[model samples]
Target chain A: MTATTPREATAPAKSTRGFLRDNALSLFFGLLFLLALGGQAAAGWADLNNRLHTDGFPPMPFGRYMTSADFAVDVAENWQSEYLQFFLYIVATIYLIQRGSSESKDPGKEGRESDEEQLIGAYAKPGSPAWARIGGWRTALYSRSLGLVMGILFLLSWLAQSIAGRAAFNADQLRQREDPVSWLSYVSSADFWNRSLQNWQSELLAVASMAILAIYLRERGSPESKPVGAPHDATGSES
Target chain B: MSNRLLAVPLCALALCAVTLSGCGAARGPQDAAVVAATHFAAAVSQHDGAAACGLLGEAPRTELEKSAGKPCAQAITGEDLPGLGRIAKVETWGEQAQVRGSSDTVFLSHLTGHWLVMAAGCTPRPGDPYDCIVTGG
Candidate 1:
C-alpha cells in the first residue's frame, strides 16, 4: 500500500557560528596583512634612523619619520609594483597563451563567452550574486572588475610613490649639501629609477617563476595546480 | 565601488592638507646662511677637528698662525667654542659668528669659513669651532 502525506517546507536556519567558521581564512589573511604592515613600519623606521646617524644628522623622532614622505614612498612603491604584477598576471592569463602552464586558460578561451560557460545571465544559478544575474552591463563589468580595480590601484599607488619619493630624495640632498631637484627632475634621476627598477625586477622574476612553475608542480586538492596524477599539459580548472 | 573611488580624491585632499601643514618654515636667506655655518660648527664640536679646520677664514687662520706661532687649529678646542649654538648669532656686520669654545668668537663671512662649505653648508673650523669658549675654565 502506498501512503500519501503532506510534506512541510521550511528554510534552513543560518547559524552565525557556521558563517564565521566558513570565512575564517579571510579573517586570518586580514590579520596577517596587518601584522606584516606593522613589521614594515618598524623595520623602515630603524633603517631611516641608521642612515641619519651615519650622515651625522640627529636621529629624527620615530613619530615624525612615520609622517615623512620618504617612508610613504618606499612602502607605496613596493605595494604598487606588487599590485601591478598581480593585476597584469590576472588579466593576461585570460587572453595570453602559455603552453603547459597551469596559470593560463586554454589557448582558444581568449575572451568572455557564453552565459552558460560563465554561469551568468539566464544561466546563473538561483543563489548566484545579483551581479551575475543582473546581466548586460553589470555582468560585463563584473567579469573584469578584479583586474580593473587592481590596475587602478597600481596607478594610484605608483603616483603616491612618486610624490613621496620626491620628498625623501630632497631631504637626502639637503643633508648632503646638494641642490634639491624638482619633482620632474627626481622622477628621471638615477635615485628614483634605481629604487623602482630594483623592486620591479624582483617582482617580474617571481611572477615569471610562478607561471612557469605550475606547469609541472602539483599539490593535491589545490586549485592553483592540477591533481597530483594529472599530466603536465593539463590546463584550466584544477578540479 | 563608486564610494571607494571617492576615497582617492579625499585621500589626496587630506595629503595636501597634511603637506601644507607640514611644509616647514623654509629657512630665510639669513637663517639659511647662518644654519650653514652652525652646521659646520656642529661637525667640528663632534671632534672632527680636520673638518672644522677646513672651515676657518684663510686670512684669520693665517693671522693666528703668524701671531700665535702655532697652527690656528692648535689654538681652538671644544672647550673654547662659543658660537656652536643652534641659533647662530650673526653679527651686525653680516658675518656669521661661529664659536671655537665658550668665549672665543669667530665671525665667518660669506664662504669665509673656507672648507666648511665643502659639503654645502659645512663650515670647516680648525678645532672645536662649535664649542662656546669657557670664560673662566
Candidate 2:
C-alpha cells in the first residue's frame, strides 16, 4: 500500500452510493407510505361504495375516488401535522434548554452564543461555507433559515389541508342537497377543526414521546438517541 | 462545436422525453372542478351524512330545517339502493352536472353534492336539475 498521504486523509469524502446504505429509514418509510396509501385507498373506496348503495347514489370508480376531496384531505391533513411537528421541534430546539433530555441543547449552552461558539464571524476557518464567513444579514438569515423554512412549509401544508378538507366537506353537503361552504367558512368549521385536531394530537404525542424517551433510551447507532453506553444524564450532544 | 450549439438539441430531446414519460397531461381547472363535483355526489350517495353536510355552502345549509330536508340515512346491512350501484354516468362542466338516474336526473355541483345528514330531511335543494348555479343540460 502507498504511504498514508495528508491530502488523502484531509480530503472530504463523497456521498454514499445508495439510500439503503445512507438512509435506511427514509427508504423503508417511503415504501411503507406507498403500501399504507394503497390500503387506505382500497378500504376508503369500498366503504364509500357501500354507503352509496344504501343512499340511492352511484358507486364511484376506484381511480375516480382517488381524486376525491376526501382522499386528498385525509392525506394532506396527516402530512400537514407531521410537517408541523417537525417545524415546531426544529424551532423549539433553537431556544429551549432541557436539563437531561437528549432532545434539547444542554442548559449550560442555552440561548444564542458568541460568534466563535457558532464558528461564524472571526472564528470561521478558511473553508467555511460562505454564509458562515459573511458575518452580516447573510449570517443572521442562515442562522434562522432552518426554522424559517420549516415554519413556511408547515403553513403551506396546513393551508393545503384546509383547502382539500373544505372541498371534501362540501361534497358531502351537495350530496344531502345542501349549499356549499366557502373556503374561509370551511377553515373555521367543525369539520376542518376536527380533522386538524385529531392529526395534531397524534403528532404532538409522538414528538413528546421522542423527546422524553430520548433522555434514557439508547438506539445503538440511531442519531435520535444517545449511544447505549452514554450516561442517562447526558444532554444535547449525542455520543 | 460549442457547448451552446449542442445544448439546444439536448434540451429539446429532454423535453420530448419528459412528455413521453407522462409528465405532460396536466389536469386543467375544468377537470378538477368535475372531479370535485363527482366526489361530492359520491360522498352523499353513500349515505355518509357527515361527509355530505361538509360539502355544502353556508347559504344552502344555513337553516337547520333546510339542512334537515335532505338528511342522509345510514343504510341497513347488506341492503343496497339500486341507484348507488356502479356509476352509470359522470359528465362535468366547470363545477356542475346533470346526473341522470334510471328514474330522475339529480343536479350536482361542487360542494353541493355531498350532504351527509343524520336523517333524510337535511339534503339541500338544487333549484332545478336544468337550472343549477352554472347552466348545464
Candidate 3:
C-alpha cells in the first residue's frame, strides 16, 4: 500500500541515529573542512610571523594575521580554483565525451537527454521533484541547478580573489618602497595573473588527471572507477 | 521552495560583504601609516633630534648614526633636514610608507607600536629605491 506514496516520497530516516548514519558523508567532510581550515590558519600565521621576524619586523598576533590581506588573498585564491574545477567538470560533462572514462557521459548520449528520459513534465512520477513536474522556467532552472551553483560559486570566489589579491599585492609593493597602483592596474598586472594562472593550471591538471586516469584504472569499489571486471572500453556506468 | 530561493541571494550578499571587508582592511593599514609618518616628520621639522631618533627603528637609527659618524642626536640635527611645512601626501602599503611634506619626503617603516623613520630627505631615483640623504640601519 505504501509502495507508491504520491509526492514527497523517500522521507529522511527519522530516528536520531538513523539521521547521523544517513548524513555521515556530509558530516565527515564538514568536520574535515573545519579541521583543515584551522590547520592552514595556524601554519600560515606561524610562517608569516617567521618571515616578518627575518625581515626585522614585529610578529603579528593570530587575530590580526587571520584578517590580513595576505591571509585573505591566499585563502580566496585556493577557493576560486577549487570552485572552478568543480564548475568546469559539471558543465563540461554535459556535451563532452571521453571514450571510456566513467566521469564522462555515454559516448552517443551527448547533448541534453530527452524530457521523457529525464523524467520531467508528464514523465515525472508522483515522487519526482515539484519543479520537474511543474514543467516551466522553474523546471528548466532546477534541471541545471547543480552546475549553476558551481558556476556562481566559481565567479564569486574569483572576484573575491581579485579584490583580496589587490590588497595583498599593494602591501607588498609598499614594503618594497614601490608605489601602489589602482585596482584596475593591479588586476591587469602580471603578479595578479600569475597567481591566478598558477592555481588554475594545478586544478585543471588534477581534474583532467582524474578524468583520464579513471579510464584505465579500477578503484575496486569506488564509484569514480569502472567495476573490477568491467571492460576497459566501458563508458559512463560506474560500479 | 522559499528557502531554496533565499539561498541564492544570501550567498551573493555574503560575497559582497567579504569584498567590502577586504577593501576596508586595506584602508585601515594606510591610515595607521599616515599617523606614523606625520609624527616622524614633525619631530624632524621641530629639530627635536632626540624625539626624531626615538622614532627611528633600531636598525634605521643605528644606520643613521653609523653613516653620520656621530650619535643620533648630534648627527640628526647636523643634516639640517629641509623644513617640512606640512604633510602634503602619504603613500603607504603593507608596512612601508612615504610621507611627503611641502619640501621633503621621508620613508617610514611600521616596526612595533609606531612607524619609524627609515629614510629622511628622500627623492625618487627612478627605477630604484628612493635616494635618501639619511640612511636607516
Candidate 4:
C-alpha cells in the first residue's frame, strides 16, 4: 500500500476545486475589462462618427475606428494613469505609514522589513518562491518584482499614449488646416499634459479617498477594510 | 511563476505599441493623398472649375458658394489659387492628410474610403492656422 503524505493528500482536493472557482476574482475582473472595452469602442466609434458627419466627412466604420489612433490614445491614457496610481501605491506603501488606514502598513512596521520578516534566504520555507530561497541579488530583485512590474506597465502605457496621441493630434491638425507638429512637440504640448494630468488627478483622489475612508469604514468581509467590530484605530488589519 | 505570467502580457503590450506606432505615414495612404491633391491641382490648372469643385468636400463647396454668392464651380475658378508644381511632401494621420506641393498646400480627409479636399490654396500664417483660399466650415 502506498503511503500518502499530508501535502500529497491535500493537493488532490485543492486541484479538484476547478480553475474557474480558484481564479474567480481575476476572471471576474477580466470579464468586466473586456466588456467595458467593447462598450468604449462602440461609444467612441459613434461619437467620432457624429463629429465627422458634422465636419462634412463620412462616418468611419467600426473596424477602422478600432485601429485608429483616436481610440488607441483614449484607451492608453486611462490605462497609463491607472497603472501609475497602482505603481505609486505599491512603492509608497513600503515606507509610508498611515496610523489607521487599511491601505498602509502599521506605523511601527514602516520601511522594507528584514529578510527574516519577509521569509527570504535562511528564513524562507521550503515551499517559498525560488528567488526567496536563493538569496542575494535574485532575492533582492524578487522582493521588488511587484512594484517594478507595475512601474514598467505604467511607462509602457504612457509611451503608447504619447505615440497614439501624436497621431490623433496630427489628424485633428490636418482636419483644421493647421500644420502637424513633431512627436516631441506633441508630447510637450498643453494637450498631452492636460490629458495626462486630468486622469492623474482623478486617480490620486481615488487612492487618497480609499486610504482615508478605509480607516473609519467597515465592509464586513472585504479584504480592503478592517473587520466590522475592529477599532477605527486598527491599522493594516483585514477581515 | 506569477512573474513569468506578468512577463507575457508586458511583452505583448510592448510589441503592440511598437506595431501600432509603426503604422504612422503608411506608404499607401500617403500615395493616395498625393494623387487626390494632384488631381485637384490639375483640374484647377486646366480651368475645369466644375471638376475642381467636384473634389471639394460638401461643406467647403457650400461655404465657397455662400461666401461668393455664386455656385462653387464659378466662384472656385475666380479665386486667386496659385499653380501647384509637383507634389513635394505628404503627411497622413488617421483619416486626414496634408499634401504639400511646390507652390501650395492642400488638406484632405478620407471620407467613405475616398480622399476629398477639405482645404486648398493654403499658406502658412505665423502663430495661427493656415490662411486658405477655400476651406470647409
Which candidate number has the best lDDT?
Answer: 4
Q: Specify the poorest-scoring 10-residue window by lDDT in model 3 chain A.
A: A6-15
TM-score for candidate 2, residues paired by index: 0.61
Instruction: Give candidate 1 regions above 4 Å deviation.
Output: A1-20, B1-137
Candidate 3 on A128-206: residue-level lDDT in tens?
Answer: 9999999889999999988887777777767777777776776665555556667788779898789889999999999
- Please give, for every candidate in the order listed, the TM-score of chain B alone compared with the true chain B: 0.42, 0.34, 0.71, 0.85
The whole-model lDDT of each prediction reads 0.59, 0.57, 0.74, 0.84
1 or 4, which is superior by DockQ? 4
lDDT of 4 by residue, B1-137 (tens): 25456557545544555455536477998899888888888888888889998788888898999999999888988888886677787888888889888899999988777888999999999778889998987
Model 1 per-residue lDDT tens digits across residues A1-239: 66544332222224556766888877787679779878987888899879765654445666766676666776777877887898888887767866677777776787765779889888999898899899889988988888888887777767667667766765564444333456688779888788788888999999888788888888787777777887887766532
What lDDT tens digits, residue by residue, belong to model 1 across residues B1-137? 24265347435633642352224323343365565566556655676655556665454444445655766466434324434444534321111222222322333434423222322223434432222231100
Winner on lDDT between 1 and 4 is 4
User: C-alpha displacement of B63 in model 2, angstroms?
Assistant: 26
Give lDDT tens digits, candidate 2, residues B4-87: 442353344334323321133234433454444445456655766465446444333334323344332322111132232333
DockQ winner between 2 and 4, please give it: 4
Docking level for model 3: acceptable
Report the TM-score measured on chain A for model 2.
0.84
TM-score of each: 0.62, 0.61, 0.84, 0.90
Docking class of predicted structure 1: incorrect
User: Model 4 segments beyond 4 Å from truth?
Assistant: A1-17, A237-239, B1-23, B69-71
Q: Is the docking of candidate 2 incorrect, acceptable, medium or high quality?
A: incorrect
